[model samples]
Target: MTTQKALIVGASGGIGQNLVQYLSEQEAWKIVGLSRSQPPLKSTAQFIAVDLLKRDDVVTKLEKLTDITHIFYTAFYGGPTFSVPVAENLAMLTNVVEAIEPVAPLLERIVLIQGGKVYGRQIGPFKTPAKGFAEK
Candidate 1:
């Protein structure tokens, strides 16, 4: 059987990178990693430098992918004085969803990290809109 293909976004972040390594180690998957600076991860061979915030780029990349079977998205825009992190994450989540919308025609799965929900403002500041891996 042919190996499955996976596209990973936010590959420079914690969960993203870990997932890449884990999936690559599986040796059953063809992994494609995406990032802004395209920072080299544990496995550099499967990497694509992309700024997900750019709509055109996202659409173009998604269009070119025909073999992708799954996607793991961990991108985020985080900061202080934020009540919209949830909404922002929802938008980005939608962006990733839409980007892969085309691939969905052929893909088997797409996973976005929602992490454990942290309710209220709490004692400290919220890290990222992604909930887990907040970008600096």
Candidate 2:
């Protein structure tokens, strides 16, 4: 049987580290961790330190990671402000997806883990109609 590989972005962070530990415990998965720094947890996961802010760097480093079955994106870029820039964050996310999609043919799913306060809640009611789930 072929080994299932999972990539955990921002593997050094709280959420990402836990994911690395959990996925590492599962015998079915081969975990590859990507972050700006190494995770503090003791894990068998293959860790790759890459700056997500730099699109070219991310592409260069992740391009060789073929046969990825899953991607858990927990990375965030706050830039120089107290809050992260929307455009920068969007660009980072887009860059990673574009870099990996072409090389990883076996890729099946990508999970983006949402953390911290829901800033969207401050934006007031949705301008568009809800597409999924009923609002309480």
Number of the top TM-score candidate: 2
Deviation of model 1 at 54, angstroms: 2.2
User: What does candidate 2 score in Cα RMSD to the true structure?
Assistant: 5.0
Residue 41's lDDT within candidate 2 is 81
| Whole-model lDDT per candidate | 0.68, 0.81
Worst 10 residues of 2 by lDDT: 127-136
TM-score of each: 0.73, 0.81
List candidate 1 segments past 4 Å from native.
80-84, 115-136
TM-score of 1: 0.73
Query: Model 1, 80: alpha-carbon shift in Å?
Result: 4.8
What is the clash count for each candidate, in the order shown?
0, 0
Backbone clash tally (model 1)? 0
Report each candidate's C-alpha RMSD, comma-separated, in the order given.
Answer: 5.6, 5.0
